[model samples]
Target: MKVIAFGASTSSSSINKALATYTANLIEGADVQVLDIANYNVPMFSEDTEKEIGQAEGAQAFLRDLSEADAFVISFAEHNGHYPAAYKNLFDWATRIDRSVFGEKPAVYLATSPGPGGAQTVLGAAVGSAPYFGGNVKASVSVPSFYENFDLDTGKVKNEEIASQLKEAVSALN
Candidate 1:
C-alpha cells in the first residue's frame, strides 16, 4: 500500500511532521510519502481570494498527492486549539475543487504538541471533518506532551506508554 503522511503545520521544525513520519514508518512494506504544508502555499481562503486566485495550483497539487495515496496519516498541529491556518486554507481550497478531497481513503488522524493536551482540539476537528471529505478515519490518536515523550533528533516516541498506544493505533492501519 502507498501511504501518504503529512503534518498540518507550516513550521520548518514541526514535531507533528516528525511524529507522523515516525508513525508512517511503522506500517510494514508500505511506500510512504511525507508532505510538508509549507510546500503547498495556497492563500487564505475567502470568496474574493478564490475569485482572484481561481482555487490555486498548490491546492490541486495537494489533491493530487491525496489521490495517489491508498491511505493517509495526518498529524494536526493546534493553533489556538484549532487547525492551523495554512492547512485549513489548503483544505478549504481543495474542498472547493472537490468535496471528496480525501476520496474515502483510509486514514489515521494523529496530533501532538509540547503540552499535555497534545493537539486534541484540532485532531477532533480533523476527525469530524474527514467524513465530509470522504476520508475514512480508521483511528485517531493524541500524543500528549510531545517533548517529554518524543525525541526530535532520533525521531522516536520516548515514553513507553505512548509508544505502546502508538503501536496499537498504527498497527491497525495494516
Candidate 2:
C-alpha cells in the first residue's frame, strides 16, 4: 500500500511532522511519502485570487501527489485552536481544484504538542470535517506532552501506552 503522510504545519522544526512520519512508517509493508506543505508555495486562497489565477500549479501538484496515495497519515498543528494558516491555505486552494480533496482515501489523523492538550481541538475539527472532503477515517490519536511521550533524537514514541495506542490506530488502515 502507498501512504501519504504530512504534518499540517509549515514550521521548519515541526514535531507534528516527525510524529506523522513515525506513525505512517508503522504501517507494515507500505510505501510512505512524507510531504512538506511549505514546498507548495501557493498564494493565499481567495475568491478574487481564484478568479485571477484560476488553479495554482502548487495546488495541482499537491493534488497529484495525494491522488497516488492509498491511505494517509496526517498530524495537525493547532494555531489558536485551528489549523495553521499555511496548511489551511494549501488545503483551501486544493479544495478549489477538487472539493473532495481527500478523494475517499482512508486516513489516520494524529495531533500532538508539548503541552497536555495534544492539539486535540484541531484534530477533532479535522476528523469532524473529513468526510465532507472525502476522507475515510480509520482512527485518530492524540499524543500529549510530546517531549515526555516521544523521543525526538530517535524519532520514536517513548511512552509505551501512547506507542501501543498508535500501533492500534495504524492497524485500522489494514
Candidate 3:
C-alpha cells in the first residue's frame, strides 16, 4: 500500500508528526511517505487571495500528493482545541481546488499533546467531518501526555498499551 502520513501541523519539532510517522510505519511492508505542512508554502486562504492568485501551487501539490495515496495516517496538533491555523489554511486552499480532498481513501486519524486531554477535541472534529471531504476514516487514536508515552530517541511508543492500540488502528486499513 502507498500510505501518506503527515502531522496536521507546521511546527518543526511536532509531537503529532512523530506520532503519525510511528503509527504509519507499523503497517507492515507498506510504502509510507511522510509530509510536512510547512514545506507546502501555502498562503492563508481568502477570497481576495484566490481571486488574485488563482490556484495555489502548494495546494495543488498537496492534492496531488493525496491523490497518490491508497491510505493515510494523519496526526492532528490541536491549537486551542481545534485545528492548527497553518493546516486549516492549507486544507482550505486544497478544498477550493477539489472539494473531496481525501479522495475517499481509508485513513487513520490521530492526535497527541503534552497534556492529558490528548488533543481529543480536534480528533473528534476530524473524525466527524472526514466523510464530507471524501475520507474513509478507519480509526482514530489520541495519545495523551506525549512526552511520557513516546520515546523520542527511538521514535517509538513507550507505553505498551498505546502501542497495541496504534497497531490495531493501523490494521483497520486492511
How do all the candidates rank in terms of lDDT, highest first? 3, 2, 1
Clashing pairs in 3: none
Off by over 4 Å in 1: none
Can you write out model 1's per-residue Cα lDDT over 1-174, one digit (the tens) per residue? 999998989999999999899988888899999999899877778999888879799999999888999999989999999988888888889999999998988888899999989988888888998888998999989999999999888899898888787777777777
TM-score-sorted candidate list, best first: 3, 2, 1
Model 2 segments beyond 4 Å from truth?
none
The 10 consecutive residues of candidate 1 with the worst lDDT sum are: 165-174
The C-alpha local distance difference test score for the whole of candidate 2 amounts to 0.95
Top candidate (lDDT) = 3
TM-scores for all predictions: 0.96, 0.99, 0.99
Candidate 2 displacement at residue 105 in angstroms:
0.9
Global local distance difference test of model 3: 0.96
- Cα lDDT, model 3, residue 23: 99
